[model samples]
Target chain A: MNLTAEEKGILQGAQGKGMQLALSTLVRYGEAFAADRMVEIHSAHLAGSFGAFIYRTYYDAIRLMVKEGLKVKVPATLNPRPLEKIKFLDRIMISQQGFLEASLAKLGVTPNYSCVCYDRENIPPQGAMLAWAESSAVQFANSVLGARTNRNSVTIDLCSAVTGKTPRFGYLLDQNRRGQVLVKVKAKKIDFPALGFLLGKKVVNRVPVLEHLECTRDDLKNMGAAMAASGAVALFHIEGVTPEAPTMKDIFDREPDEIITITEEELASLRSFEKSKPEMVVFGCPHLTMSEVKTLGEFYRGKQVKLPTYFCMIPRVRQELGGTDLLRDLEAAGVRVTAQCPLAAWTIRALGRKTILTNSGKLYYYLHKSEYGATEDCLKFSGVSS
Target chain B: MKELQGRGIISGQATGKALVTSQPLNLTSGLSKPWNLFNRLAAVYYDRHHELYKKDLYNRVLVFPQTIGSTFTGMVILETIRRGRAPLAMVVQQADTLLTSGLILAEVWLHKKVPLIEVPDPQLFNLIKTNDLVEVNGDTGAIRIIG
Candidate 1:
């Protein structure tokens, strides 16, 4: 497979037992994709934040790596913890949270604890190679930021971080990055997440290039999250919005293999469940940034939520908004703010499994019981922006 | 006897009744329900959104289009294997990184392997069905429908 001497040394156990195992797995994983050589990665984002006691083997594996003094060669960040202040859930299931935190810390993770790892501190340059996990982050980075990374699984994500190498195939190669599907957006209102959900279902696991959709960065982020959830879409491009696809000819090799239109009514159907009022509302499935929080804060300005409303933010981003009046204003309106993963938080059956209303299509796709809603509609049910 | 050839991503051999579904399986969300914790017998497929909802996956040849959802897919899958409650082997329409991660980790580090094969043919679902005895050889990428 044309492994470098150093890689070969690691595979032959010249580095250590843990190092050997990590490299060996990458080689095997790469061979499956027909990757002939390894590419060095600029950074990594891990999705191994869940530390439930049910995952003893995972914990043991992490412990072994830590014991072997295995550390990330490049900068790294983590996904959110499974349980964050939801005391109603079973504690025994996640008894190993602290152990995992310590293990990851020893491995030199940034502890930002958000799926949106590229937000501020760890933004990689365009065309930078990465070995990131978390479907949403991989999609956003590949699509929006034009970074190259395949959807490396959780353990593989960590292994790439430790070794600073990934199999050079899939999205890392230029040929595979070309958009295979042409997605025409006929939606009048362009509900970002819902549009993304529709796009994902239509073009599963294929790169899609969107046409005639004027979108903001936050809109793209939310849309990409949903796309990754409903489908295995790791990368997508909007006509001029994303880094790669500036024009039709720029992103596609030929006329797209498939073309699908997403209309306002189709998006409405995805959010049709908004008719059934949700027991609670959630936002930030990919973890909201400060700008997103401020936008929603204006909706909650001088208003209280009708039902249980929660805003999940990246811990660092939440801290960034700490002293802002928007944070103060939202707190005054009784909107619960926490740095947690809605996908993980809402999935706990102990939370009584109530129907959830979320603006995040990713959450709608994953949460045990969730309904898609527009920003105003979700806020309407929560007695905001009235 | 019915036979098909495909690519084997993980190497092993096992035989079990096929639990076939055309839908993509989100192993992370599917097995995360409290049912797996409560049931000592088998890893219950509890994702209500899936077509194979509330079915038992233990020691069966789990056949699906592919896996979807979070990177946590690997660990959830590994945990099931550790608990002796996973499918004997998996035959997927396309084996992505998430589905193969946990099994590969188990094989490399934990010395426990579950044969995972990828049959890219669309007609694989048409031939296999639930309750049909299936034999899978991960080394040769051979799947036999031995009813």
Candidate 2:
């Protein structure tokens, strides 16, 4: 594999232990993908939600490596969820704070617990190599910000942090990024949540050119989150939308491999709605923004929901709602704003899941597996109006 | 007993009695219930509703496959280490760098070294059971049950 002089220097032990590990992994990963050279990245967003399996090793590895003279130079970022959101008096977030804190201290990295790092600050340059994993973040960086990144793992991200480069393959390769699948939505101006549910269920890992998706940049954000939650989609081309796919032809890359049609029937049939009395309502699996929250609040508008509904929001977004009549209105309407997501918190145990209703496709999908009562009839009965 | 031995990276290793689980743990999705904690050993995203496997205090090491969960899982490892409840070594079905990274960091922070290994084959599941004593070598990717 070809590497720039700086990267080579780092590998040669000029940069330090952290950088050495970083560069070595980047080169290895690049070689694995058959890439020729490494590309520079501005920001590094670490995986937000990993299990104890990851925590047990990453902290120790960084501490040891950093002692060998490696450091993360560029500003690093992290996924949205903290390890343990509530430590009560401890004031700890993120998994494994003790180990992670020491590891970060050793490497001199600060925590920025935000998913949309590019949105928050310092967007990477177009074609920049990003070592991010979240499907939504990957789509935003590649499609919206025009920053290039493969669906990298936690190890790969750390490697990039040290080496300051990534393998030039996968989404980074121009030829590999073109759309292979064509998906057309017949519904007029699809709802963000429903559209995401329909597409996520239909599209697994393939790159598809989405047609008839009347979405702005913001809607695309929601769509990407939904897609990430349901499937392993790394990139998507929205026809007549997105910067990369300026025209329908561009979406095909060089040529179309296959085209698949998504109809309203298939979309509706994805969810199994067995009729039952509604016991609990849940929202926010991929997470909801202020705009979606507002729309949901307005839909309920003094209408007391028979089932207890917990609307999950990010801390910042939740803070934004503070002191606003939105909070008062929501509470009065029986919509409680939760800092932790329903999936994250077991509010259902307190509320009891006799039947659960949700507008989010992701949340709806998890309800059954989590062993909640089915309330498909209630969701349909609520209609598009609600 | 047929023994396959190789030097391997040990994660969540312990010197106590062995509690081995051949079932693969899925950390991608959330787990709920009294069994959620034990069933989804890798997942640390959900609230601590289940206390089944709260800490690795058991002298025996808990064995399983690759971990799947939210990114901050390193914290869970740290807690286990701090409470002196962590396993002495860990044996995974695959070489999951993410999971390994967390366990290694926890071990380092606690200033202890544990034996860890990625199993030689996915089919090693057929040869192992809970509470079986085995030596793991991550370097050579080997597993040998104590006879």
Q: Who wins the lDDT comparison?
A: 1
Give the alpha carbon lDDT tens digit for every residue of B19-55 in model 2: 5654433233433322333443432334232222333
- For the candidates in turn, chain A alone yields TM-scores of 0.97, 0.80
Q: TM-score of candidate 1's chain B against its reference?
A: 0.95
Count clashing residue pairs in model 1: 0
Superposed model 1: Cα runs more than 4 Å off: A86-90, A273-275
Error of 1 at A97 (Å): 1.0
Best by TM-score: 1
True contacts kept of each: 0.78, 0.08
- Index of the highest-DockQ prediction: 1
lDDT of 1 by residue, A220-312 (tens): 889988888888889999897888988888888898898888777888888755466588888888888888888788889888878889999
